[model samples]
Target: MEKFEALIGEMEEYGRSNHVPIINEKGMPVLLEMVRQKKPHRVLEIGTAIGYSALLIANNSADDVEIDTLELSQERADIARAYIDRSAYKDRIRIHIGDAGENILKLSGKYDFVFIDAAKGQYPDYFRKVYPLLTENAMVLADNVLFRGYVRGAAECPRRFKTIVKRLREYISLVSENNEFETVIREDGDGLAVSQRLPKENNR
Candidate 1:
């Protein structure tokens, strides 16, 4: 927890300028483990809020690995760019200024790892867009699927957010039920859904 607190402190001190979303250290350590184990050459991140997660992944990965992050907000992108430029990880991370939904379609390279932390309501759409870009054995890590427990207690959520929550629930359910991939839904910090792309032969 100390490491998480330290990360939070750093975010408070400098990341506020970029509106960086705070992450729980619990999920971060696991994410880093996944990156190290996978040793992905290319990583795609759908959201670049302050680029904290992207930086963390890069720091834990091989030096040759590269991270491409998409961020729609110019202000946040600028702040993320500044932070990356000043940090030792500047060379490994590249930020794209545009909506992830449309921008991801234009991306040509295959990705071994995809991290989704964008608009909660758009996660399913993100998955659909990213599916074709993933290489065999690729992994997609979707964050905040549990919506801080609100997902289970749908009756308790507010009217506006309830729809988003329902959508996320559906997305998780659909992914978990799909035989093409093996999905793991873990309850840690807002909940993380990990889906690994199965080999083509495994589909049948």
Candidate 2:
């Protein structure tokens, strides 16, 4: 994992200079491997905090895939735009500024993958929004579900972030109990949940 940490350092340094949130490169590489395996045609990302994760997904895929990312924070969105504008990947990624849920509702095309890394409390809401946009066999990945190991102790957390953590657990549990998709929780930077849509016959 030393080599992975080196990459994460490099990404964090870049983010420091560019004013964006840096993704955990070590954790992200695993997701990138999954992207490479899936070879998705289109990707929808709900959080573009400086576009780190979206960029990773795009880089792992062939040139044909298009990545659309949403960011609610205008400052972060501008930072992402600047970084994308300076990079060769400018054309491959489009960062939309607004509520991710609203943007998802307005999106016209289907996606082969969706990445969720926004506000923890909104996971279920975001899932509902993105569900209709996913095609058969599409996968959705939600990050930081463990909430720094506080999800299990949400009741003890301070009231503000506590509610969100509780909601996230509920979201995770709901997904776990559902039969329409298969979900796997990974122990990585914070935590990761990967859910792939099951075939139509498997849906209730």
Candidate 3:
């Protein structure tokens, strides 16, 4: 346990020094709690930045859980691999390097939990692709849904972020309005959208 804590500390420092965005302190508890409660046997992560959240998920989940994390950058995936290699979960978390949008489609397992922290503008696309791959009652947690208080906040969206903010709104709408999902948004770090799929019999 001590060794794992030290390794996690190093991962956090590395992310900060390198400008890599991992989950913030406020939102991490919510994520870990979900992992513990759901006890998902198969987890799919859309973004693996240094493997911070992936490690956390594996640590909190059941002993036999399998985590498949996707990364767009080879360089970042290498860094994440180095970190995972240092932990007891090296064999549990598999990092796939490629465009996450395309990588998600190639995956074929029924994932019970999905964590999305990748391209904010492509969130709707990611959500749509991953929807069919999820098991019933699967929980989809999306990070940064509220980009800098622009998604549902009163702040004006900048010209540069218009598309991203627009897409995020669409992503939220997709889950919120879907008859098969029960969605809730937490106003934590950036913002986290929690959506749980209803059973087939319960879906309208």
Candidate 4:
């Protein structure tokens, strides 16, 4: 475990230097704790940016956990695959390169744990696609949902990011309003929306 932690530190440094977005330290503990408590058998991650978060999940999860991660950019996917191969959880993690929406539909088995950290604007669509694949009591965590706090405030955001902010607001509302799910918005890191699918009996 010490060796893995060291490797994760190295990866974090690499991500910072390379300008690749990875999970922040504040958000790491939240994810780690969720994995520890959930003990999910199958985990799904939407963004495979350099594989930092995916590796983190794999390292913290049970030995039998299977992780499927998606990446849109082939270049990024290559780098992520290399990093994952060097990790102890390499065999348990699978990197799927392509659009997340399409690849998500191709997944066969249901996942009890899902982490979404991909394009901020596509979060609602991703949620729709992954919703059907979630098992009872499944946990779906969406990272960067707050988008640097712009989603909550009226502060002027850059024109390029306004659409993303708008979509994220919609996504948050959709999840929070859904009766089948219970959602909590955490202020860790950029922001995280930790949602759990309610049992059929409890949905009412």
Off by over 4 Å in 1: 1-9, 16-19
Which prediction has the highest lDDT against the true structure? 3
- lDDT for each of the candidates? 0.82, 0.80, 0.93, 0.91
Model 3: weakest 10-residue lDDT segment is: 1-10
Candidate 2 to truth, TM: 0.86
Residue 99, model 2, lDDT: 84
RMSD per candidate (Å) reads: 3.6, 4.0, 1.2, 1.4
Q: For candidate 1, write residues 1-204 as lDDT tens digits.
A: 135435535755665554457456667766776788888889999889877887778767777888999999998888778666756678889899988999999888899999898899999889888889989889888888989788975348878798789789888987888788889987877888988878989873
Q: How many residue pairs clash in each candidate?
A: 0, 0, 0, 0
- Candidate 1 yields a Cα-based lDDT of 0.82
Error of 2 at 113 (Å): 0.5
Ranking by TM-score: 3, 4, 1, 2
Model 3: lDDT equals 0.93
Worst 10 residues of 1 by lDDT: 1-10
In order of appearance, the predictions have TM-scores of 0.88, 0.86, 0.97, 0.96
